[model samples]
Target chain A: MDSLNSLIDGFGTALTPVNLLWAALGVLLGTAIGVLPGIGPAMAVALLLPVTYGLEPTGAFIMFAGIYYGAMFGGSTTSILLNTPGESAAVVAAMEGHPMAKAGRGPQALAAAAIGHFAGGMIGTVLLVVLAPTVASLAVDIGAPDYFAIMVLAFIAVTSVLGSSRIRGLASLLIGLTIGLVGLDQMTGQQRLTFGSLQLADGVDVVIVAVGLFAIGEALWVAAHLRRSTGEPIPVGRPWLGRDDLRRTWKSWLRGPVIGFPFGAIPAGGAEIPTFLSYVTEKRLSKHREEFGKGAIEGVAGPESAASASAAGTLVSMLTLGLPTTAVAAVMLAAFQQYGIQPGPLLFEREPELVWGLIASLFVGMVLLLALNLPLAPLWAKLLRIPRPYLYAGILFFAAVGAYAVGGEAADLVILLVIGLIGLGMRRYGLPVLPAVIGVILGPAAEQQLRRALQISDGSASGLVDTPFSVTVYGVVLLILAWPLVRKQVTRRMAARR
Target chain B: MTTGTAGPTPGPKRAHWLRDHSELGVSVLLLVLGVLVLTDALTMSVDLTQRGPVGPRTVPLVVGGGLLVIAVLLAADVLRGGRGEAEGGEDIDLAEPADWRTVLLLAGVFLANAVLIGPFGFPVSGALLFWGSAWALGSRHYDRDPLIAAGLSLVTYFVFDSLLGVPLPGGPLMGVV
Candidate 1:
């Protein structure tokens, strides 16, 4: 009931004519950018960060919420039509959705996805409203040692739990920490790796790091292997569901958010797991199970909603815990920090209007996204027909401008180029990009908590593990580390049984 | 398709295998970066008052040490036939050989943008960045691309500087627009 009242008040702020317009415009821009081949929600938000610079913090965050939902919707559209997902979360949707496109049911797939996004988005946002305050209140009891332990847990989870190789992920994360170390040390005001440059003191801006990695690296990679021709783009019509399609999809719409929100609310629980789980569950239960590989509506419907719910779930953790489980969330966290606003347990209490307003806008953003994109689906497909050369050139062009515009220093462009090169190298070497991003954002904060924990203990290391919360978190971290070796042994025992 | 089987290509393929070992480049990079971090940490002069048991140097030492271990482990993995697969995306074609010339050209364009943005301001240099990048990416519309690039730069300049009040420098045209 308290959450309901706050949400109603939030609507008062979000529904202002100006804020409403920004939400619509963000959805429009996010969809346009998200339709591009390689751009993800993270890149879309990073590139568009400059647009909201002129606004007040509340309105700016409202626009960001809009962009987040829009990117997910746009990514689903592309996956269905082109079999090219802008991010990993949408990869499952493409497996069935693309086959539908090939079979010329492109419009139906889009319809299902848009509706699923709308449905999951609604359910997830409601849960977020109801649950975030409770979580934040629970989080208020957390001390520095527990905070440090949680950050370490986040670091271990992102590196070890998600990626193909833990070593490569850890290496990427360490490199990001090194980059984060370049500026002044937060506690002591000492320079760690400045190399004695005045510009180095301020540190590499997160926008520069993000745009450099996702935009510039992607452009360079594509330029090196530019495919002269492309797959025949499926022509899409207005996305509208028939009676049969609705009957097939309504249950999935409910089930998806139910599966997605829980995973998203936890640290290191990325959308991919719940989304895949949704799809597999749907496959096993559907009467049309045979229709799945051949373009079943349930495959598109289930995963699309699951992914959106997962996106909402990530925000719950982001708003309350300051833990970013996805690349998009990490970038959003950086954006919050840029405005000198810390997002954590204190955030809701500190800025209730902004918090509730941002959450309210998610609901508003979903309605606007579905209403706008359904009829405009064909136009977004037309965006994909944009030639490769112009598209990439524009990416580099904006990246340079955004990098330069942030600090108005030519030095930033240099930093941008260098990070872009590093990003290229990371991609070439198969390093997972998420851990590095998480490291850069969380690196300084982790150091702060570590030192503070020790300070309270008068330099005793046991302070780090004194709390039960810390012990439990560390135990989980150790379990994650040892799981692969344990898994091999378990499998061998099973083989012996066989 | 014809070029694929054009000759007894012990050529690009074998050279690729030999160059495959060049992945040690990443290990070398990690080693160099680790050494740099450690050297910086070790040489730091700290005010004694600022010294906690864990000071500024502590995180760097841990980070640097981690980098070294990972570097050595990665090299061993490479020797034992572990390879990090190059990332694939919608636009990426891993089968195609990397066109280094295009990449180098793009980097040169960016560096030029960095250098020129200071003197020439955003409009002139931004146009150069867009146009140069387009050219590097193989857009040969020399007749029309320059006009579009210039247009884009001016529009963004007006929007960001005039409307948004970001205070972008206009260089020689400082007073004109």
Candidate 2:
């Protein structure tokens, strides 16, 4: 009842004419940029983040709610129509959705995806509402050791689970941690890696790091291998689900959120796994098993819903625990910091209205996204027709503006370009960007927590495992670390026996 | 993922392991960075007044050590013929060789913007960035590109500076706007 009452008040804040207007603008802008061939949700958010610094935090977050879902839908639309997913999460949608587009069932596939996004977002938001407060309250009592353990768990999970090479992920993560270590030590004010430069004293801004890696780095990478030919999205009519389509998709829409929410709530629970899992789950349960890879509407419905639902699940961790499990969530965490808001257990207690209003705005944003996208799906697709040169140039332009806007010094822009090159190197070598991002955001926090724990123990490392929660988390980290080796051994043994 | 499996296949044709495994450069960079971090941490002048058992240097030592270890492991992997698959996207044509010319051109433009933003202000510099990048990316509409770049730069300036109140240096136009 308490949560319900708070949610209703949140609606009161979100339903205002001005707030609704900003939400609509966020959706429009997010989808417009997000629909471009190469831009993903994270880039879309980063691109738009600089300009929104003018707005109040509540309004800005509400707008971000719209922008977040709008970017996701835009990425999905591009994937379905052009087989061009901006990032890995949308790969599942392209698996079946693109095939459907090629088969001239583009409208139906889009309908299923739109509805699926809506259903999953709705259900997941509901779950976030019900579960966030309870989690927050529980997290409030968690001590430094437990917190440190959780951050360590997150570090290992992101490094090990993502990308093809664990070593590469770790390297990227260490690079980010080093960047995090660049600033003066929070406790003692001693510089660790400033290299005697006064500018380096404050360390790199998260906004600059984010913009550099995702936007500038991405633009340069695209520039390095620019193609002559342009990719076009398949032309589509209005998206609508027929009776049979509705019946086939309803269960999947419901099931998708169920599978995705939990995965997204966990550290390094990226959208790829849940979407793929939902796709596999749907295939196993489907009466149209043969159609799983061949443009099945159920395939589109399941994974799209799963992806959207997983996005909400990511919020559960971000809003409650302040640990970002995905790239976009990491950028969103940086955004929270920019707004002078620290998202954690006390966030709800400190800013009840902002938290609840953000949740309610998510619900509002979902409805707005579905309403706008269904009728204007074709319009969004036309964004692909934009010339690639102008598109990438625009990204760089905005990245500069955003980077400069952070501190208004040319220094940030310089840092952006330099880090951007490193980002390019990472992409060239198959280093996943998420671990690097997570490391930059979490490294300092982890160090601080570690220090606090050790201080409490008066230098005994045993304090790290004194808590039951810390012990369990460490156990999970050990399992994650050992799982790959065990799997490799098992596979080798099986091959040898064969 | 790539299947160019970097194991020692014992083929004379691929005997130039160092040349063939160019990705070793990444590990080299990692190594250099590791050394930098370790040296910095070891040399850090921590104050005696520091309270915690773990000072700021402790985390850097661990992170620096991890980086060095990863560098060695990655180098070994590359030597064994393991390759890190380059990322791909819709616009990228991986089959084609990297066009370093364009990348350098874009970087030059970016660097110019950074240098010029202080002297000429955001309007002139940001416009130059847009136009230069478009040209580098193969946009040939010279007549219209500048107009668009200028318009875009001005709009951004107005949005961030005028509307949002971010203090972008206006240079000569400081008094006019």
Candidate 3:
């Protein structure tokens, strides 16, 4: 009942004209960029961060939230229609959606995807509204050691689970941590790796790193692989959903949110695991399991819903615990810090209007997204028909403009190129980029927490592991780090038996 | 894993051992980089505070240690012949040469932006950038490319400069715009 009242209050803030406009703009821009081959919400939000400097916090965040969910929706359109996944979460969608497109049931796939997005997003948001306060209350009891342990767990889980190879993932994470160390050391106020440059005083901006890596690096990599090629164009099918299609897909849509929400809330658990799990679950449970690789509607619906739901779930964690489960969430956390607002357990109690208003706007944004996606999907599809050259060129242009917009520093452009090359190399070597981004965002905060925990316990080494709660958190981290080795041995014995 | 009848499975002969252990090579390189970073970090003079057990070096040291452990583990895995292939589920085609045109074009775009951004400002430099990228991406329609490029540059100019209030570089041709 308390949640119901506050949700109505949230609606009041979300429905204001200015907030609505911000939401619309975010979704529009999100969809536009999301259709592009390499750009994702993380890059989009990074590009927009400097621009959002002037807007009210609530309005800016409303737009950022819209972009996050909007990209998840838009990413599926490309996956189904063109077999090109603009984001990692959409990779599963592409697997099944493309086959469906080839079978001339692309419209049915699109309908399932759109409906799934709505269902998943709504359910994820509902969980956020209900579960966030409870989680936050628990968080308030956490001390510096506990927080440090949690971060360590997050670092381990994210790098190991997100990619095909855990080694490559850790390497990627190390690179990010190194980059995070580039600025002035926070504790001593001394430069660690600035190389004595005056611009090194403030350290590299998170926006520049994100834009360079995602937008510029992506462009450079694509350019390196560019080829004159063509394929049998997949035609856009009818846009309307048949009643039978709806009946078939609704159950999957409902199930997707339930699966995705918990994954989103867990630290280091991201959309990829939930999406893959959703696909496997749907395949095992479906009455028409045979239809899975042959344009199954459930295949398209379940994963797409789970992906969006997980995205919403990540937002809940970010706003409440100040923890980011994904790359985009990390960047947004940086954005929040830039505004001088440290998001934690007390945020809702401190700024109820901002939190609730943001929640309300998500509901409104989801509605607008469905309207934009369902009827105008062809327009979105036409984005692919545009020459790749023009699209990529536009990305480079924006990259330079975005870099220069922040203080008009020419050196930032140079940094962008350098980082772009680094990004390209990482991609070529199969390294995940998210961990590095995490390191950059959380490095200083982690240092501060470690110092605080130590100060409380004197100079003793045992001080680091003194608290019961902290010890438990570290115990969990150790298990996560060790699980891979255990799993490998088990798998080897199983294979030997086979 | 279904071993499809593509070929004789190469008799499990471990075709191209170097390719299989590429990730191992990468892990070694990362370990070296981590060592280099640690050396650099250690070179800095630290002013210790008496107030706390953990100092400024604690976080970096921990991260560096984690990197070393992970890298060594990865190298061991690679050395043990535990690494998988590219997982294409298909036979490899080795005859294709790398695409160099895109490499040159992307480099050109970055160079042009860096050089021109200060002198010509955001609009003109951005226009060139847009047009060049479009050309690089394989747009053959010359008639439409420049117009689209200029239009995109201008729209970006307005959004960043007017709407967002970001002060984009206006190079030597600043007043002309």
Top-TM-score candidate index: 1
Lowest lDDT 10-mer window, candidate 1 chain B?
A: B1-10
Looking at candidate 1 chain A, the ten consecutive residues that score lowest on lDDT are A46-55
Root-mean-square deviation (CA) per prediction: 2.4, 3.0, 4.6
Per-candidate TM-scores read 0.96, 0.95, 0.90
DockQ top scorer: 2
Candidate 3 residue runs with Cα over 4 Å from true position: A230-233, A267-269, A466-469, A489-498, B1-32, B48-51, B64-96
lDDT of each: 0.85, 0.86, 0.77
Q: Write the per-residue lDDT of candidate 2 for residues A1-498, one digit (tens) a residue.
A: 899999999999989998888888878876775577778778877766775567788888877767777777777888899888855777889999999999999999999998898998899999999999999998887789988988898799999988888989898999999899998899988977888899999988888888889998899998888888877678999998899999999999999999888988987556889999999999999999888778999999998898888889989998988878888888888889888787888898999999998899888888889998899999988888888999999999989988888888888888999999999988988888878888888888899999999999999999899988789889999999999999999999999999
**Candidate 1, residues A1-498: lDDT per residue as tens digits?**
887898888999999998888788878877876677877778877876665466688887887778778888888888988888866778888989999989989999999998998999899998898889998997877789988988898899889987688889998999888888988888778887898898999888888888888888878978877887776668878888899999999999899999988888775547788889999999998999889899999999988898889888999989998888888888888889878888888998898899998899888899899887899988888888887878888889888878877888988988988898888888888888878888888898899999999999989999899988789889988998898999999999999999
Chain A TM-score, candidate 2? 0.96
Q: Mind giving the per-residue lDDT tens digits that candidate 3 earns over A274-339? A: 998999999998998988887788888999999889988898778877878887888788788768
Q: Candidate 3 residues B136-170, lDDT tens each?
A: 66777789888887788778877777777777766
Judged by whole-model lDDT over C-alpha atoms, candidate 3 comes out at: 0.77
* Stretches of candidate 2 exceeding 4 Å from the true structure: A51-53, A489-498, B1-16, B174-177
Model 3 residue pairs with clashes: A176-A436, A389-B134, B119-B172, B121-B170, B121-B171
In angstroms, the error of model 2 at A175 is 0.4
